[model samples]
Target: MTKAKVGIIFGGKSAEHEVSLQSAKNIVDAIDKDKYDVVLLGIDKDGKWHLNDQSSYLLNEENPKLIQLNKTNKGVAIVPGEVTDQLVNLSGSEALGQLDVVFPILHGTLGEDGSIQGMLRLANLPFVGTGVLGSAVSMDKDIAKRLLKEAGISVAKSVTLTKNKRDQINYEEVKTKLGLPMFIKPANQGSSVGVSKVRNEQEFNAGINDAFLYDHKLLIEETVIGREVECAVLGNENPIASLPGEILPQTDFYSYESKYIDEKGADLAIPADLTDELTKKVQEAAVEVFQSLNCEGLARVDFFLKDDGELVVNEVNTLPGFTRISMYPKLWDISGISYPELINKLIELAIERHQRDLQLKNAVYED
Candidate 1:
């Protein structure tokens, strides 16, 4: 049997570039070599795409901070258009090979915020994770919460602040509205990149500034005191959610450093210590959120399990982390799916979705 060619695109023009590199390395290492011909594509901070060598990129996995798309002089820019999966190299307009499916392991900003997904959709390429609408909606915390609320899902009470209205922010009014110990984060980022837990006026002001550095819009959410739980949702129409996983962050909260940089920053309890009823409820809610957003391929739905056992949707990660120890795969691992198998299943889902979409009557013409 001929192996499928899978393009694993990573390293984006986002703050999570390092995380993307790490995720790409892990996916490349675990993807079944006999089942797929892997292609490594890199996107630099300037958003330039390149055809990268898998092995050479993997070498930077040891110290992801040192990884950059410019590290290799062999630059071949890819322009995603022409309504085909055949990527063209800018150097000579040479064929960069046909791709069966692309697994974009990019976490934040342009990659996960629907920029890359939109480009792939225009190119008519089959790629893993959510479509442009879902990605765009879910990446923006403000819009996602509104949609989730409309879908009858419980989301954190948050006040959206934009760069223009930043000066008008009154700490006292904010404290009275959202209260202290709130979470200030970039409304459009993931992996807790610009997330900060504010306990006092000083931290609240500083957190706002820090969050604004990453994005123009900021979200100040009322802190829900509970265990940070996550559920992995897979498939398209009839998606299934994995067993719940609890995150015990060693730091004040699950910050970017806690998520990727620090080794002992957080601990995961797969199959979180929740009663069967609560677990089922969470899983059901996760699937609901997934379907509500029209997410395809896979997504990791985060939630806060309160002391009274109520589950509030934190946010939906359309393209969550894929490292071996990441919650998405870890929850599935305990739920009877291996890491490699999970990767394969995602690719299959992407292809299935593409095929299904292609069958739709998309055009009308006069005979």
Candidate 2:
């Protein structure tokens, strides 16, 4: 059987660009070479897409640095055609070939926020991760929390502040409402970018200002005192949850620096020391959050397991980091799925979901 061509797209115009590069590098290394032919695509900070060589793509592997798009590499121009001729060189000199499936290893912003997914949908191509609606809703913390709350899921009490209402915010009132040690974050970012822990009014104001720099909407969530646990969910429908993992952050919280840059940022405890009953509860809640948000392909559902055994949904990451040290794959690895196997399963899930979607009547009028 001929190997399927898998396009691994990464390095997006987002705060998590570095994280995305790291993920793509790891994915390229672990993907089954016998089963799939890999194609590397990079989106630069300026949002231009280029087809990069394998050596150029894995430039960051040795030192574990962020890889940037090599401007000299052939530019990729989407031809907007049938499945066989979508991706081609901008000069139109080379067809570059077609992709059987695309694994977008990008995180945050335009990459994970449904823009690329929308483009893939228009191109009639199958790609990994959530669909447009799921990606959009999951990227926005405000919307995700609201939907999760409406679904009878417990979430941290929080308030959403938009740039227009910046001046109207009463810090004292916010303090009274959400209390101290608040978690301030950009509503649409991931990998903990522009996220801060505010203990006093000074930090609260600064955190909000910093968060607004990344996004117009900011979320101020009351601190939930519990173990920071996460569960990985996979599949389009009837998703299965991996054994929970606990994050032991060396920093005050899991900051961006701690997550990607810092060497001693955090430690993971797979199958987190929870009772069998509590473990089941966490897994069940993870699946609920995944389905509630209409997530497909895969997602990492974070939760706060309180001392009293209350499982509070933290957030759902539709395109969770796929770095070697990332929690999503690590949890699944502990649950008997190897790294390569996990990658294969995700790609299969994407294709399976696409085939299922093809069965539905998509056009409004019959031809």
Candidate 3:
């Protein structure tokens, strides 16, 4: 079999750009060398794509493969046509080879928000992970929550604040509705980039201001006091959910520092200590939410098992973290899927979906 040319695109124009770089590095270093050839592309903070080849370290370092936006760089994109000469190097200075697949390691905003997927779709590229609709639905916390709720899934009560809606958000009214210790987060950000747990009026005011910096829309979800569990979902049509894993954060909630930078901040509970019945429920809920959101290729579904021990859906991460220590891969690794094999599986799903889509008549004509 011909080795597929895999383009690992990372470092997007999102708050999680640095995290994306670290993720891509781990994947590139760990992916099975014999099976796939790799190309690294970086999207700068300004959203320009470029070839990035620089020093990379795991979750620790901030240097996300150095990048420069120029037409001559080997930044990967779908070749516009299936002509014999498929790959088009906009940078005429050199010729870069065609890519068989794209592994998007982009986090947050432009990367996970369906913008990149839109571009990839326009270029007719087969990229790993969720497509445009799924990505868009999952990225917006408000929409995601509603969809899950409509599907009869338990979700935390949330109030979405959109632009031009400066209607008085009274402290008493909000606290009465969602209660104190509610979670405030950027509607479309991940990696805990703009998330905060507010315990009081002062904290609530400040947290909202902070979250608004990352996205125009803000979501405040009522805090669900329960064990935090995660399950990884994979594949296109009939996706499977991995065994659930519990997270015990060293601090209040899984904050950014607790997740990546802090060594002693969080611990993982694999095959989470749960009754057989509860386990089955969680796994089923994870798969249900995945399908409900139209997610393809992959997703990490989070849930809160309340003090009463009933499971409630928290959120769906279309492109969850890929770092070795990240919950998505860690949960799968413990579930019998290794890093390289997981990567391969994702690519296969992407190709399968793309091929299926190709079979559909996309053009509209009038007689």
Candidate 4:
């Protein structure tokens, strides 16, 4: 039997570029070599794609903050509208070989915001994670909350603001509405890149400025007093939710540094201590959120499990972090799936979804 060639695309123009590099490295290492052939596709901070060598693709591989994609002269470009899954070399205009499927280990902005997914769709290639619409909807916190709320799922109370409304932002007004110790974050960013926990007027003013640095739109959310719990969902039509995991943040919150940089920043509680009833509720809610957002393949549904036994949806990560300590894979790992097995399952899911999509009609014929 011929092994499937898997293209693992990582790094991006987003602030989470370093995080993506880390994820790609882990996937490349853990992926079953006997069943699949791995290809390294790295994207730089400037948004250029390159055919990276798997062994030496990352610089400072041990340090999360310092880790980065090693610059490569072998640039690559996707040939859209082609079903062959071929990537072209920029310099010589040569074929970079065909891939059976692509695993985009990218996080935030262009990678997770439907941009790369749309490009892959145009190329008629199968890629891991959610589709374009699902990716777009899940990446934007503001839009995601609205949809979840409409679907009868509880989400954090948040006020969305665009760049044009910057002047209209009144610290006192927002403080009164959201109360003290609110969370300010970019609407479209992940890994808590520009997230800030502001407790006073001064912090609120500063947080607003900081969040806007990442995206034109921002979200001011009322801080929920609850434990941070997450559930990982897998599959397409009949998706299943894994056992919930808890994040014990050592810092004020799960900041970017705590998530990626600091080794002891947070303690992960796999299969979080919860009553069977509460676990069932969370699992059910997670699957509902996945289906509600039309998410296929996989997603990590974050929630604030209130002391009163209420589960408020925080946000949905379509392409959640796959870092060694990342919650998405860890949760599944505790739920009977190993790291390598999880990677294989994701690729299978991607191919499954692509085959289903191929059966859809793209045009109407006039008789």
Most accurate candidate by lDDT: 4
Clashing pairs in 3: none
Tens-place lDDT digits, model 4, residues 280-367: 9999999999999989999999999999999999889998888888999999999999999999999999999999998998889945
| Per-candidate clash tally | 0, 0, 0, 0
- How displaced is residue 345 in candidate 1, in Å? 0.5
Q: Write the per-residue lDDT of candidate 3 for residues 1-88, one digit (tens) a residue.
A: 7898888888767877766766887798788889998876766667656665534322345433332222224543445665333344
- TM-scores of all models? 0.95, 0.97, 0.91, 0.98
lDDT of 2 by residue, 39-80 (tens): 888888888888888876645454545455555457886665
Best by TM-score: 4
Q: Number of clashes in model 4?
A: 0
Would you list the C-alpha lDDT of every candidate in the order shown?
A: 0.86, 0.88, 0.81, 0.91
The deviation in Å at residue 247 for candidate 4 is 0.8
